[model samples]
Target: MRHLLAALFLALSTVAAAQQAPRIAVTDLAYEEQVARYFQYTRFQGKSSHRESERYADSDYSSRGSARSSGRTEIDYESISGDIVYIDRGELRKFTADIKGEMLKSGVYRVVQAKPYTAKDNEKLYDVIDRIKKGYFPNADYVLFGSITSVEPRRELNPIQGSDAISASLSMELVAEFSLIDTKTYEVKAAFSAMGEGQDMRLLKDPGQVAHLSRGKVMREVAQSLGVDVATQLEEQFNPGAARRARGDRYREETIERREERIIEYR
Candidate 1:
């Protein structure tokens, strides 16, 4: 009789504990080709201009006889400008993973770390997150989701009109947004955004190196900030505390310092 009673109590405790935990689901950074641009185009005299040409079939119907088709070619020269939703696999992996990690560490809620996804692969957010919603984290109560609205890193190489010297510049800019929603009701609980930008200038034989560095640093730094921002917001909503706030501020300060140092070193 005692064994049976103890078993019942243990089962009830397990059930209670499970009930107290809330499941949260997160998705990858969503983006479309139109929005997935990574660089801004500035006219660099003869350097930045390029011609794009394409050919298509032009079919004509002859009133007297058979139809005739001829290949028609057109070409255009255009300068790239504005925000692009360029997808960098490494950049995105670091981003979504970090966000998931921070949410897990908060311990106030259960996070369902979602699988990898390419936003452009699916046309709709539901299409991107459907598998995770239906198969993986089906029991989640709330969903945290969003997209990479803009990703543009500036790397300019300009040759002085009068001199032979070339000036190289490195800069990174990334922006992401999120919507926290109640899964059952599909109501948006909150919306948030985070952005990161860093830049440096130096004369270099390989201007590409500067651009690469900027891309890497900006992606990682932006990811960190996004993770912290989301985690802090979640903390405030679920379990508010002065200590957590202080710790988060300290972390941000350190990140800013490191970012400054990295840029300054290139010069």
Candidate 2:
């Protein structure tokens, strides 16, 4: 009887251990491009002039029956003018990659590399959650889905005057917003915004040129800030240490329960 009981208990314990192990499915990570509108200003110098001329002719009857004198007058004027113009042009590239990399470092969730899809294509939020759940978790405790909600460029108009020209500079600011959804619960887990600003630089010639220079710096800052948040979130969500700690607590509980059972059996 003792042998039979021990065998049965071992089998049951094995099954329980298998059930306790977490079956995690990490679906492919998805990201949407958030193109930021950029503004820039430039100055130029040009010269123009106006001229007027008059002609008069004199004829003398006695001294010059055949002689004539002619005179001409010329007037010239020139001036310089300065202009300040505002322009909205250009775009920031490779924004999605920066966001994804930062999110991966956050360690909040297991992110898999998956196919690229847009929020428009998958309109309903639930559809995205369902897709992730199917890919990462046919049976899972949690599922995470997110998309880029908005990307807007904030411009601070700056005007500067020079001796020959007036120029305007666009102080560029890039802001990106994201929304996250939970699959099983079908709830919004989090929504937040991030921003990056580029250092002010005078683009001497044109807004387009200035935009080109400032965009890189702005995007870099945005990427850095985003990465920090992503790393923090990931750590909170899927850190191995958390799982280990939970298992440790469960083991302690099991030990206490086993001890109580043994005492009862002895009695």
Candidate 3:
């Protein structure tokens, strides 16, 4: 009876271990910088300027003697000025600033306000991954990390009319490249590139507005790609029975023996 009880306890322990959920560490996604350029109208040079001025002249005379008295009348002149307005560069700058702010606030991707990473900064990618893993999943079975490999921006010119006259407009295209790595095997898991484009509407202005629009679009694409890749990786590493147990599936007495048999077969 003592030996039989010991064996039963051992079996229970094995079953418990097999039902434990596998831990996976998902590192922060890395992405390349994306740029978009658009022409924003800043100032209009042909607008009219106006000024107004007023003038007054007056004269008065008086007699010294009380018997004789004299009075003089005075006249004044006044003027007002007005002018029609034209488009200017200031308008373009304001519009561009508005667009840029909107894009940054959209939160489609992690936007970097500063200059992009240099070749020397490439090491930071691995460092970030390692730090995240250490903090979130010290004993995790799998760690996924990646980095931004490249970013290229190309601009094309178009022509449009401004308040002053015809001006050159710009359209920008951005390309981004990313690479995924497996921490355990030190192997590259996936690599891909994405591109997005934006057009500037203000022909007589700054190009920053359209650039932001393009960046936002690219960010959305990057996120979708990352989701698909991560899903695939998880599927590959998943253990079916562990997943079911983690999801709160109960084991039946009859199926318990079959499950044990399958686990043994897989092991």
Q: Tens-digit lDDT track for model 3 on 1-267?
A: 345544565576456655453333444334433344443333323334445555555457643322333455444444444543432111011111222233223321121221122324443544545544444435544443333344344444454544443343344443334333344554554455434444443343554433233544444444444344434433444334345444333333334556567878998
Model 1 is weakest, by summed lDDT over 10 consecutive residues, at 43-52
RMSD of each: 22.3, 16.0, 19.5
Candidate 2 lDDT, 37-110, residue by residue in tens = 55545555555555555555566643322434555555455554555444322223344455556544433343
TM-score of each: 0.48, 0.39, 0.29
How well does model 3 score by local distance difference test? 0.40
Clash counts for the predictions, in order: 7, 10, 15
Evaluated with lDDT, which candidate comes out highest? 1
Off by over 4 Å in 1: 1-19, 35-94, 115-121, 126-133, 156-169, 198-214, 237-267
| Higher-ranked by lDDT: 1 or 2 | 1
Cα deviation at 244, candidate 2, in Å, is 4.3
Lowest summed lDDT across 10 adjacent residues in model 2 is found at: 21-30
Q: C-alpha displacement of 135 in model 2, angstroms?
A: 4.4
Task: Tell me the TM-score of model 2.
Answer: 0.39
Q: What stretches of model 2 exceed 4 Å from their correct place?
A: 1-94, 106-109, 118-126, 133-144, 147-150, 154-191, 203-212, 233-267
Better model by TM-score, 2 or 3? 2
